[model samples]
Target: MPHFRIETNVPKSKIPQDFVSKAIPVLAKALGKPEQYCVVSLIAEVPMNFGGSTDPCAIGNLMSIGALGVEQNKKHAKVLFELVERELGVPQDRMYITFQDEPTGNVGFKGTTFHSLFG
Candidate 1:
């Protein structure tokens, strides 16, 4: 599973209604994961600031069982940052995204952990 969570200072009204729809496919393609197993969430109107400014900045994280690493994350960042910019009007420079390589055992799905299912 790949879950992309974005916390932004942008108001809820400013976010596009089709934001999640647009993000899932893009994120799935970037992570090379099936869209069915990918999740995307946006928390708008968050109290956040970046570099002493609060002008539509965001903090995001991508947590997944695989498809994340030094070189891979760079590419994911480009795609995801573009998505956030287009959907939330948050500039690429103002957003920070963290990549996480999750252990299968650490993630639960369908009433069981990935580790148990895959192992």
Candidate 2:
């Protein structure tokens, strides 16, 4: 399963439906998984100020799906940033993306683990 947690200074009500629709397919294609496997959670951060020494103009996490190498992750980040900018009006310069892969047996579902569901 691919889980996405998106945090933004933008209002939750302002988020575009098209953005969510397009994101699932695009992310699924990039991850080589079915769209049905994608799980997304959008969190709105009001009164948030983004900017720092390490990551200036940082808005929020772009991609929090699975672990990939730096180069590959950056590539995905670029896609995510562009989408957010175009769809949500968030600037590319004001975002950061991170990915972490859950261990094989870590994530679970209703009454069983993700692996159990598939296996």
Candidate 3:
């Protein structure tokens, strides 16, 4: 499972209608995961201050069972940042993204943990 969640100061109306749609494929391709298992969410119009400015900025979190590390995350950051900037007008310099490698045992799906299913 891979989840990409972004919270931005950009207003909802300013967010493109195809933002999530565009992000899904990008995230899936970057993580080498199936599009069906990828989740992308955007919370727009958030009250956020970055570097003491209320300008267009975002905080992103990416959680996945695998496919996350220094090199991989660097690639993901590049692709995802481009998508955000193109769709939400949030510059890459104004955003920060954090990555997390989730434990399969801690994530459940279809009434059972992924560890139980995969292990």
Candidate 4:
């Protein structure tokens, strides 16, 4: 599972209508995952601040099972920054993206942890 979430101070009305739809493919390719297994969520028009200012900024988190590393994260961050800039006009410098590598034992699906399925 590669779950990506966006929390931004930008107004939803200012965002492109097809932004979310366009993001699916970008996210999948960024993570080297199939689109069907990826999840993208947006929490827009929310209060956010960075460097003690309420400028147009975003804090994003991507949680996933494997497929995360320094180089991969750098690449993902680049695409994410472009996306945020396109949708919210938030500069890359004003945005932050965090990648969390969740182990299978810690991620559960159905009635059991993903670790159990492979074991």
Q: Pick the candidate with the highest lDDT.
A: 3
All candidates: TM-score: 0.96, 0.77, 0.97, 0.90
**Is candidate 1 or 3 superior in lDDT?**
3
Per-residue lDDT over 26-109 for candidate 2, one digit per residue giving the tens place of the 0 to 100 score = 777767678887866666644556664332233444333354567777777777777777776677877766677675467777
> After superposing candidate 4, which stretches have Cα over 4 Å from the reference?
none
Pairs of residues at least 3 apart in sequence or in different chains that clash in candidate 3? none
Q: In order, what lDDT does every prediction score?
A: 0.93, 0.66, 0.93, 0.87
Rank order (by lDDT, best first): 3, 1, 4, 2
Clashes per candidate, residues 3 or more apart or on different chains: 0, 1, 0, 0
| TM-score, cand. 1 | 0.96
In Å, residue 39's CA in model 2 sits off its true spot by 1.6
lDDT by residue (tens digit), candidate 3, 25-82: 9999999999999999999899999999999999999999989999999899999999
- Which should have the higher TM-score, number 2 or number 3? 3
Question: What's the distance in Å from true for residue 79, model 2?
Answer: 1.0
Where is model 2 more than 4 Å wrong at Cα?
Answer: 52-67
Task: Report the backbone clash tally of model 2.
Answer: 1
Give the C-alpha miss distance for residue 80 in model 2, angstroms: 0.8
Worst 10 residues of 1 by lDDT: 79-88
RMSD (Å) per prediction: 0.8, 3.7, 0.8, 1.5
